[model samples]
Target chain A: EPEVTQTPSHQVTQMGQEVILRCVPISNHLYFYWYRQILGQKVEFLVSFYNNEISEKSEIFDDQFSVERPDGSNFTLKIRSTKLEDSAMYFCASRGPTEIHYEQYFGPGTRLTVT
Target chain B: SQQGEEDPQALSIQEGENATMNCSYKTSINNLQWYRQNSGRGLVHLILIRSNEREKHSGRLRVTLDTSKKSSSLLITASRAADTASYFCATYVMGFQKLVFGTGTRLLVSP
Candidate 1:
């Protein structure tokens, strides 16, 4: 089965530094999303993308956060200034272009450690 | 927060035992989905039950959704050690446009 893939399984960055998490969603998927999970916490939605634009976002997705589909295959989340609270497991997910009804396939996730 | 809440935050059972997890939510949803996550890993989709469906099953996993009650349950029968993972219930918001996941139930199936 085709699955979403993310790069840099682990990321360590200094506080206030910029970080961009990359994801390659399933080739035919039309909806892409980014979510985060704090250690021992439930997953939180960050943003959703379709047609090269963000469809909806949460308060957690502030000015410091931006998403881009630089290419047809790559969806990336960029944090302009990282903070200690920003450290979490960031997961990329994709859905659609299948017969299954409304299921998002998640990637292995990138563990972001902000020090 | 429109997040779902799961009960029995942690459970431990021996192999061949049945494990059941329950979830409740506070909002109207289009569907409910269950996912599993190994320690520090990503989520694995388990099964989904639409708001219109009362129950659905896949393999040893069974999911039930009560739209009127705004609750769902996941049951794993004759589970194995490999089934030990954190199970989460996610609700679809805005007609499948977004998902709100709940605090998961961590199950440990001992061999």
Candidate 2:
């Protein structure tokens, strides 16, 4: 089965530095999303994208965060400045067309570690 | 205490036994979904129960939704050791495009 895939399975960056987490969602899916999980915490929604534009975002997705679909298959989340609290597992997910929008396929996730 | 919360943060069972986890939400939802995640791995979609549906089954997994009570349950019958993982219930809240995940219930099935 086709699955969402993310690059840089593990990323380590210095505090105040920038980092980009990339994902290639399942082809043919129309909606894409980004979520993050702090160690031992619930998975929190960051943002959703459709038609190459942001559909919705959470408070945690402040100015520091931005998402881009620079190409047909690549969806990326960029954090301008990282903080210690920013360290977490960032997951990328995609949902099928309208008929199957309820089910989302998730990628293996990129573990971001900011020191 | 949040939008989505699951009871019994951890559960232990033996092979061939059954496991059930309950999840509660605070708001109306378009649909509720169950997902499983092995340690350090990606989430695997299990089942999704729509707001209008009372119950749904896929293989050994069963999911029930009670929109009136804002609660849902996931049951794995005759579970195997491979069934051990953290189970999470996520809600696609009404009028929202994103999914809100609940604190997961970790299951450990010994062979």
Candidate 3:
């Protein structure tokens, strides 16, 4: 079964530093998303991307965050300046044909730790 | 601020026993999905039940949706030790692609 893949399984950065998380969604998927899970907490939606534009974003996805599909296969989330509270596990997900009730496939996730 | 919330923060059972988790949402949804995540890993899609559908099944997993009550339940029968994981319920609100996830139920199955 094809699955979403993300790079940099774990990252540690200092406060005020920048970090880029990359994901390669399933080849045929049309919709992509980014979510974060603060240690032992519920998963929180950050942003959704479709057709090279942001479809919707949660309040957690503020000015510090931005997502881009720079190529047909690569989708990335960039954090301008990391903060201690920003430490969490970031997951990338994708789904095919938004009209149908298809399940979203999630990647293994990148553990972001800010000091 | 959480749209979906699950009950019984944690559960434990024997290998052959059954496990059930419940989720409640605050608003109307297009569809509800259940996912499982092993320790420190990504989520795996388990099942999806639309608002119009009352019940759905896949192998040993059964999912029931009660849109009128804004609640849903997931049942896993004859579970194995490997089935131990955190289960989450996510709701896709109407007119959008975002999915709001609930606090997960942590299941620990002993062999």
**Top candidate when judged by TM-score against the true structure:** 2
Q: What is the C-alpha lDDT profile of model 2 across B1-111, one tens digit per residue? A: 898899879999999999999999999899999999999888899999999999999999989889889999999999899999999999999899989999999999999
Candidate 1 clashing pairs, residues 3+ apart or interchain: none
Between prediction 1 and prediction 3, which has the larger DockQ? 3
The TM-score of the first chain in every model comes to: 0.96, 0.97, 0.97
Clashing pairs in model 2, backbone N/Cα/C closer than 3 A: none
- Give the Cα error of residue A13 in candidate 2, in Å: 0.6
RMSD of each: 1.4, 0.8, 1.0
Residue A7 error, candidate 1, Å: 0.8
Best by DockQ: 3
Q: Please give me the DockQ of candidate 2 compared with the native complex.
A: 0.94
Considering the two chains of model 3, state its CAPRI-style docking category: high
lDDT of model 3, residue A60:
93
Q: What is the C-alpha lDDT profile of model 1 across A15-94, one tens digit per residue?
A: 99999999999999999999999998899999999888999999999999999999989999999999999999999999
True contacts kept of each: 0.78, 0.94, 1.00
DockQ of each candidate relative to the true complex: 0.79, 0.94, 0.95
Candidates by DockQ, descending order: 3, 2, 1
TM-score: the better of candidates 2 and 3: 2
